[model samples]
Target: MTVQDIRSFNRFYTHLIGALDHGRHLYAPYTLTESRVLYELAHAPRTDVADLRTQLHLDAGYLTRILDKFERDGLVERGPSERDPRRRRIRLTPRGRETAELLDERARQAVGTLLAGVAPEDRPRLAEALRTVRALLSGGRVPRPEDVVLRAPAPGDLGWIVQRNAALYAAEYGWNAEYEALVARIVADYAQDHDPRRERVWIAELDGRPVGCVMCVRDTAPGAARLRLLLVEPDARGLGIGDRLVAAVVAFAREAGCREVVLWTNDVLAAARRIYRRHGFTPVAEKPHRSFGKDLVGQDWRLDLRAASE
Candidate 1:
């Protein structure tokens, strides 16, 4: 799963970057690796052909060729190291710095353009995900489930909640447009009429994208809260997001002084059922029903938070 996920992301990222002028550094007549070399020279405290070759894992001969090109273009100056005359140190020329700056701006704008549609609220997730990718690729420490962030719905997150849930259910369960409409309606209602004290939504983010979500809303029964719309992305499953989301809802219910928390789900949703059971919810009722283009048994479960909290 890890390998497939990484490969999928690679394909997506490659396509995304390629759309930015085939992944070449825009506004610079340099290939990606060439630009990287310039970036290191511009930023690194000490840079030499040997260090660049080792750090970048480029062949020594190949790195020397790149340096030769940079020197010819007046983008770099090389001289014998002060500490070891046998070794050569490299530095960016003024023109090289100018080129690097241009490359930097182009890169920044390119990323900004890609994320322009992203809600300002979710930018932190994107940053975190980038760090995770770097760490994973570099064979560094990987974050645990507790490292996953649960945040409030940012702009566009509500829409995402509806879209992803609908899409996932449709693909996985053979449900149809009716389910999508239901999700859209639920989101619309929440958006229009949620009470701050009694209603809340949490979006579980992994690597800057919404992987799961849940809502705790005022139940029709007085002093009760309804746990609604719990979902976890397929890739993010087994990471405890569903468990975390349910836990968040239950905790909030207790904090808000709700006497009980309730939820309704189909029996076919085995994983979710297990999560709810672990959190002390007991099945209160079950009935056969036709919904979302399927004939299924719907179960209502409730958690007596007052009892559980004590």
Candidate 2:
């Protein structure tokens, strides 16, 4: 949130990654900058030395020194550009390419080792957080739909459902802990036991992080499915995550042969209600209710899946 906080995290992360300015790094015998140049040369073979220097933002003198060292070691060869006789170009030798491969492999192994300690289910969340930080700091645009993933609930995701739902409702609508408890029970019931073939849940991920969720569970009626806990994080709302989650529920319910799908919602959730209606859910009943520290109008919606498929 503050400059100091960001700087502190940078310090911690650099140290954690062993990014010391010495000859000993994942790519040993080559300094970070040297290894970086080698990597660029390997990927962009026969690259213009001037273009490489500009891309990496290295000082002219510093870059000349590194290239000089590489040439002395027979790792690279400087020559004229292929199409132009006068323009300068540089290329990695076979030995340089081999060294670049080693650096890449070592970097991967090091990152894999560092990530091995994270819980398998939490890895996606961690990736999402990192992507978010990078995008924000780099002034990137919001995630596209291709970046969204719909996945089955994993370990700890149910708890995330309860916590995020509770916190968001409280912050947005002044809802109380009662809403949180209700969400807890719903996920807890699913956790205890549910027919996986007929009942399903989806966690919507944006850039590998959970940004939304929904559930389809068996209703009291024999052939009815109840849609519950449809939620999208506020930051991710306009990206069609809510629409994607709702569509998943409908598709799953139809595939499970449910005659009808039902859901209960308070009228205050206008965006969610719109998404439901767009997916062919109709408001079948409405009533005043006192719950979650508010006097809300609760509505019951039903979608005739059989009719919809027709």
**Can you give the TM-score per candidate against the true fold?**
0.58, 0.59
TM-score of 1: 0.58
Question: Best candidate per lDDT, number?
Answer: 2
Put down candidate 2 lDDT per residue, 199-237, tens digits, no spaces: 878888776568999999999998999999999998887
* Backbone clash numbers for all candidates listed: 2, 0
Clashing pairs in 1: 125-208, 126-208
- Per TM-score, the best of the predicted structures is 2
